[model samples]
Target: MRTVAARTTALAAVVTAIGLLPWLSGKDPALSVLRARSAEQEATEEALTAIRDDLGLGSGPVALLGRWADGVVHGDLGVSWVSGTDVLPSVISGLGVSLGLMGASLAVALLLAAALSTATLVRGARGTLRGGAATGGAPAAMLASVPEFLLATVLLIALGVWLGWLPTSGWQGPSSLVLPALAMGVPAGGLLGRLVDDALPAVFGERWVGLWRTSGVTSRRIAFAALRRAVPAIVPQFGLVAVGLTGGAVAVETVFAVPGIGRAALGAAKAQDLPMIQGAVLVLLVLGLTAGALAHLVRVRLLGPGLRDAALALPSPPRMRAGRVARAVPVVLAGVLLVVIGWGLLRDPFTVEATARLAAPSWAHPMGTDGLGRDVLARLGHGAASTVGVALAVCLISYLFALTIGFLPAFSAGVADIANALPPVIAGILVAAVLGPGTVGASVAVALISWPPLAAHASALVQETRAAGFLTAQQAIGSTPRRILTRHILPAVAGPVARHAVLRLPGIALALASLGFLGLGAQPPAPEWGLLLDESRAYVERAPWAALAPAAALALLAGFAVSLSAWAGAGPRGAAAPAKAVS
Candidate 1:
């Protein structure tokens, strides 16, 4: 009953929010429909009324919400506000493919994560990578920083265009799904890998492993045991990855021209097909919710009642000072990124020169010109401001908001799950509906969904710290809960949370890039990295640098930010017992 209620509430919230789009945007439903259906149609009062009456847009909020809710319940996703086609069948046709793609991508993610995690754990047996998620430094973050769209684009160019190895576009049998799956799965694997890699150390640090080792247990056997114990704890994170894949599909499908629900939703949004949008989102929501629930169940079952009940404090992972090599990587990368960003700050990325369009790289034009004949170097330089600069700003804002919310563990974690399950693209769609497509809306959309993770982390650390002897000592002295949290608990949690925020830079930047690629962020004349990649698509074969420049720059910047974050972890460890870890 509780599960049903939560699901229903989530459904209702989504339906209500989408139904209020027109009113919230202050746009006339009828006029918007008229323009979407026929730009040539004159918006006469009679025609407007006819459209309102036909589409039932004349109804009030209550009626509209009720209608959408009923429709969703009945599997009658209504007719497209433009096409008048039943949205259920339209959505279902592609939803199957998307689901299939999602499954394959998830499998690929698990495989990659297991491999990477195994390698990381084994390698770190002597040093750096064993402690926590942030400890892997650049590799995982760099992988995550490479957005799905960018990955898909590169694969398309290399495998499809250059080598003629696989089918480049379309959902033509199983062969077509490979690249798209990799595109979506690689980053997910990187994310999952970091979680598992950093977590197993805590299990390894357990007394049982050390006890078994002394009792003649082989290292391999002990490692396996540690993995089993650690995995269930982080199982819920896989659900977040599942949700992330659905979002990734949106951009991946667009790049690959796959007939997935993501592409359907994108088309529907462009055409203002309201019912189609609702139907697509509903499908995504159901799948995401279902995946999250299943992951939770898996965690519960794997642990069973014994571990779940017997489990002591879920100690927050420790942050150790990185080794010299680990510390150097980020510094080098940051210096390179800083140079690129600084150079970009001074260049002009907007001036067009048709004669030099698609120009090859030369002394006169270092990075060459783009499809529009705009200097690539200038755009590369200036685009850094929007992409890298905004990402940094968003991270700072999200961290601040998360810190405030962290004191309430239950609320913060729940919201984090919901936000994680709901794709950032969903937020982008909502923001676009409310404020139109632009960088600011996209940035706000990214910020809106990105903070929950940090909040949940902070909350977890807070709870863990609350159980520590020191906080109890404070309470015994009559310290108020607020003062305890602000003065003691938050300060301890702050160091770990700050490191997380730094590590999050690459992913946030990647999200912004994905939005831009989907046309939900920056439009043309804006040299935002994703937008630049999108515009470069037409002439990619003729001038590969147009695409390569930004892609390379993205990886460079992402690696730099992440490496910097990891390197910075070498600072003062936390003050509390659970707040910091050495190995």
Candidate 2:
């Protein structure tokens, strides 16, 4: 009870601290509002002073926090400085839209995952499951790899342009939601299907399953039983998928012109509307926490008494004998990346041909032309390089930060917990606001946000290794602490760290794209993927290929990264032997 009380208190304090971040940002709310309103700057200083006074900007942090807390308690989220309306109502309305979209997407993903999982299981009985899974899952894996913006763009082009089946971008009616939902759900469904596929072997191998088999149970019945047993594991992963869906919703909302909280938050962040941004972030945080708590409760209720041990148990690593092609996947992906990078370097990315503006794909302009008549192929190549470069740099910096700080007592597990609670988009916005926008700012933001999770993983791996008997023996034999760390601890953590870096690349790419999409990264003509998406929107209907080319490149790169991460390893495995003596 005491521990629970302490934890609640800690969470409250953290929420309060987050609420106070807008003030610490040192942005003059009045000036931000005036600038957004495009008002004259000549008389703004006096107006800004009065505006600040009206908003109680001169009040100390404690007083401000108290007032904010009181408002929050009373269900008042303050007013949007930009919109000049009550923030709560707008947030609620946005939440409704987001919820509807999220629900639709999640349902589609779950249903697809179940169907794919069942297919894989049915194929298992024929002794061709491996080949079947590889062939069947390949497209899903590719779809899963595609970044959100690219996926949305592709769908919009295909459905709206080529086929003329649906409206490209709007929330006018029920028909409009289909493309966006499919774009958001398909990739997630692929990931969930892969997870279900992986879990099936263990489920089928369980001792109790033999009894069912001997009793003349059909493969389909056994598969359904296996699926039921796998639900607990799949549920927690679905929770993660939900989080990803929420994050991706922002970009999806923007692409489809959906009036959800994500789009509102994006506009707020871009305009530096502190009140709206804070309110949106707080709501998102609450939603994330609520979802996680619900997932935990469901897991506990479903798994019963064994839930505690299961939660604590380390995941087993992939075996060395796992297929050669699977093991070589990362290498193959790396080679493909090298080729793309080489192609990008050999081409001119900025040559404009005004005569070919908005042209379809042709021999002269292979991937077609943008609104400005710039070659889509050239821009795609350059964008691919930029995206890959930023992701790699962010991963490298984040890994180094994790490795260095992960060993420090000052950066504890609690710190990681708090950091984990903060959303990546919020972090990116804050960092971008402070540092101003560019690749450097985006990279810094991503690295800072990326490090905590990696650090926590590394810390756990180190602790697990340190608890082993061999380490204690080395210490007793008078080996220096430095030597032991160098020879044992570092080596033990290396594989996990590498795998984590590989896995993190796609997310970092997405973050980079998000920042770029928001105009917080590489500026015009830089050919960053997200920036291209933003720029191509105006020409999407006229020359769909303008957007399609960069979208395809971004998707392919992100997909390659995802595939490599999966092929790398299944994260840190359990220690080979127990730490304590068996005697």
What's the lDDT for all of these models?
Answer: 0.75, 0.69
Worst 10 residues of 1 by lDDT: 574-583
lDDT of candidate 1 over 401-458, digit per residue (tens): 8888888866665565455556878778777777778889888989888887677677
lDDT of 1 at 412: 64
Over 1-583, each residue of candidate 2 has an lDDT whose tens digit, in order, gives 3323433553685567556755656765467666655655554578778766877766767777888888988998887776778889988999999888988988888887877666667665333454222334555555565666677888888888789999877789889889889878887887777777666655555566678877887877777676667667656656556656766777788888999888887787777776777777677666655665676667667777966447432223224344787767767766765676566566677888788788898877777888888877777777877787888888888888787766773555556445544445555665555555678877776676676667776777888888999988998999999999999999888777767766767778877887787677888979887898889888777877777666665665666665665565444453121100000
Per-residue lDDT, model 1, residue 37, is 76
Per-candidate RMSD, Å: 4.5, 5.2
Query: What's each prediction's TM-score?
Result: 0.87, 0.87
Q: Which stretches of candidate 1 lie over 4 Å from their true place?
A: 1-11, 119-141, 210-224, 308-320, 407-410, 457-503, 570-583
Model 1 TM: 0.87
Colliding pairs, model 1: 318-581, 344-381
